[model samples]
Target: MAESDAWILTTGLNNGVSKLVGEGISQYRLLRRHPKDVVCIGLTMWGTINEKTRIDLKKASQIGASDEACKRQIRDDVQEDKETLDPHHTHCILFDSGNLNEYLSDSQRSSFVQYVCDDKNSHACKEVFFDNMNFQQRLIEL
Candidate 1:
């Protein structure tokens, strides 16, 4: 349990562990009344997501891009190195390292969790990353 709001972070891929995370979120959402009660964030590397898919994501955020246009972009695509994002996630954060192949470094996720746990610095939001975690900012994540 957490003294403050909780967050769920994942790679956002529709396969493997990330896929399971998405399913869990779906079940949680079913019982919760408010949609914003929980935050499940999908963090992924920009290089992994396809170019057109990237565009669709951008447009999807703004004007609500048509489902058909988004479909056309991936019509000819064969599933290979690229990953399909889990639809259950509430938000997707694509990190661009400017490299063709890049993933979340341990330090990247670590630092972010640290910042969130450190309530003193996170004046913008008072969120407790985990139970055993305090202002000391130990490796507390979920």
Candidate 2:
């Protein structure tokens, strides 16, 4: 793959889909002995429990502020928190979905798709929707 090529894996760090893909990427890299050539990016929604906790603690001093104020502060602070990536991942992308069930907007989806598939050489990419597939089926498909 060219330096511009990348593999975008959309899933949360703690979720089953992410684990499966991370493992697969690791194994494939090991087999080829060229880990640096494969860029595995994990994309996930912000505001997970783990993420909130870390952000809260980091901004503990501001907890006493008004609810709305605290919320705004947390939002601003979390935006700068770049350590959310899973250890096994090569890179990370976080989307600002207010709630867990919120789907990406049409433009967001299009931009993300373009980013992953933009490479001229056509690197392979897979998107696994956890709600649409059972764990066993996802593993087999991947």
Best by lDDT: 1
Q: Write the per-residue lDDT of candidate 1 for residues 13-90, one digit (tens) a residue.
A: 787877887787787778667644567677778777765667777676766566653453444655546776789877
**Cα shift from native, residue 24, model 2 (Å):** 1.8
TM-score of structure candidate 2? 0.46
lDDT of 2 by residue, 58-80 (tens): 46656554555444434444554
Score residue 108 of candidate 2 by CA lDDT.
Answer: 60
Q: How many backbone clashes does candidate 1 have?
A: 0
Looking at model 1, the pairs that clash are: none
For residue 13, give model 1's deviation from the true position in Å: 1.4
lDDT, candidate 2, at 64: 53
As for model 2, its CA RMSD to the true structure in angstroms is 9.5
